[model samples]
Target: MNSDKVLDARGLACPMPIVKTKKAINELETGQVLEVHATDKGAKADLAAWSRSGGHELLESAEENDVFKFWIKKG
Candidate 1:
């Protein structure tokens, strides 16, 4: 994951988290990985849905210390 880009969205809410993820992904080349971190509870589902709808790959998701981390690979 060293080659992946990380977007820290912790403290952001709702659409902002997903929106930032989308923006970051747009800057990445296809097949590149994006690591997103957010504190919003909605992040898990929102990111998953966004990845699915956009045809991207959700590589991993986990919660730790109230923070959500999403690893996505751009399609």
Candidate 2:
């Protein structure tokens, strides 16, 4: 997925990825996408829930080489 900005949250733990994603998404305009790279296994569920509650759209997510990637569209 194409993203307006990419956030490298690899190696970070729990709320850190969500926290950084929140801060990064806040800088984007509505409809823009933010691509996040993370190593935290829990981020998959955490971000999905955060996106819903925060009003952002979690377009898609995937994992490669143990890294989880998520594409989120700002709402």
In TM-score terms, candidate 1 sits at 0.95
Regions more than 4 Å wrong, model 2: none
Off by over 4 Å in 1: 1-3
Cα displacement (angstroms), candidate 1, residue 57, comes to 0.5
- Model 2, 1-75: lDDT tens digits are 788999999999998999999999999999999999999999999999999999999999999999999999999
User: Which one is best on TM-score?
Assistant: 2
Residue-wise lDDT of candidate 1 within 1-75, one digit each (tens)? Answer: 443799999999898999899999999999999999999998898899999999999999888999998899999
- What lDDT does each candidate get? 0.92, 0.97
**Residue 4 CA displacement from its true place in model 2, Å:** 0.4
Q: 31 in model 2: Cα distance from truth in Å?
A: 0.6
